[model samples]
Target: MSEFRLDERLERDSDFLTKIGLCELRLMKDGRWPWLVLVPQRPDVSEVFDLTPLDQTMLTFETVLVTEALKTVTGATKINTGALGNIVRQLHVHVVARSEGDANWPGPVWGHGTAEPRSTEDTKALAARILDALKP
Candidate 1:
């Protein structure tokens, strides 16, 4: 299959997502749940299994690294990771930290509410903390 690339739609939406660490971390557009999205630098891969075995392994490691980082920084009650391309088909994983009082608590975070959008400064601070907590 061809390499994965963000489509025009995703690319356009990414502008706002980028201001926050979400873009740097290849995270998704959701603003709640202290979530993250990790996409391998390689571009037409759609699913994790589509990656070469080595890349697949690296993605798994990245997922764990991100999970640990979020847990430490956000003190999330649970770390939820998955890859659902119903929207963006790039081979990327979502790492969302769940808490009882979170915005989307007790339900999926996809469309329950409008994204409040993190502030540039706050996002940077959060990103820095996440980076500092990262092991790899």
Candidate 2:
């Protein structure tokens, strides 16, 4: 196995917030809605079941747990989850909370508009809140 989680490696390699959770819980980027990326930190794997049986099971369990937790946190009208890796082939699943009139209403969030970057303090506080919620 790799020394570090693939998601950890990606987070370290990027400037994004190193929020919380390793596999199960979501590390959301603080925003109007709860948008999460569930990434199993296994290396060189494309498919979900590419993981060992144990890891695959863990991933499934984690996905469900995060989905429910996100619902509780966001209270969204709908929850959308998908794995689209056209840009990053790192096997990450996205969980987005949906409402009736979101910015990308009736459309995909990607390529719809420029991302609204959160303020530093706001981002930090949001991350802290999510971390606290995900904590055991």
Candidate 3:
């Protein structure tokens, strides 16, 4: 069997955050919103259903864990979580902190505008805060 590997696109597009349980946590480079992606460390699994029952449950817990952490860190008006694999075939869940009057406002974040990448310092600070929040 092949070992698990992160999708190339995900690697290029996001910054690696701390790992939580069975998932590799990542911060989307776009600073437009407080966004995180959770990718299960499983080989060739392109959907949630592809994971074992145990893995699926762990993923759910991590999703909520990430969502709450992001909400607390960003103080967003709402948190959006989804597993839309339309563009990236790798099975990953997105936990986004949304606010009214943001770049996309009431619409979806996808394709709303060009991504404004975060500064290295800002990204490191944000990642640290999130990792701290994930601690038990």
Highest TM-score: give the candidate number.
3
Model 2: how far residue 124 lies from native, Å: 2.8
lDDT of each structure? 0.67, 0.64, 0.91
Question: lDDT tens string, model 2, 1-136?
Answer: 5543555544542234333344533444435556777777667767776778887787777777666766776677888888777767778777777887987766766555555666668766655665555556
Q: Ten residues in a row with the worst lDDT in model 3?
A: 105-114
Per-model TM-score on C-alpha atoms: 0.79, 0.74, 0.96
Model 1, position 118, has a per-residue lDDT of 67
The stretch of ten residues in a row with the least summed lDDT in candidate 1 is 15-24
- Candidate 1 lDDT, 13-78, residue by residue in tens: 432223122223544444665767776766667777767888777777667777898899998888
Superposed Cα deviation of residue 66, candidate 3 (Å): 0.6
Candidate 3, lDDT over the whole model: 0.91
Q: Which of the two, 1 or 2, has more lDDT?
A: 1
Comparison by TM-score, 1 against 2, better one: 1
Could you tell me how far off, in angstroms, the CA of residue 18 lies in candidate 1 after the best superposition?
Answer: 12
Minimum summed lDDT over a 10-residue window in model 2 is located at: 12-21
What's the CA RMSD for each of the models? 4.1, 3.6, 0.9
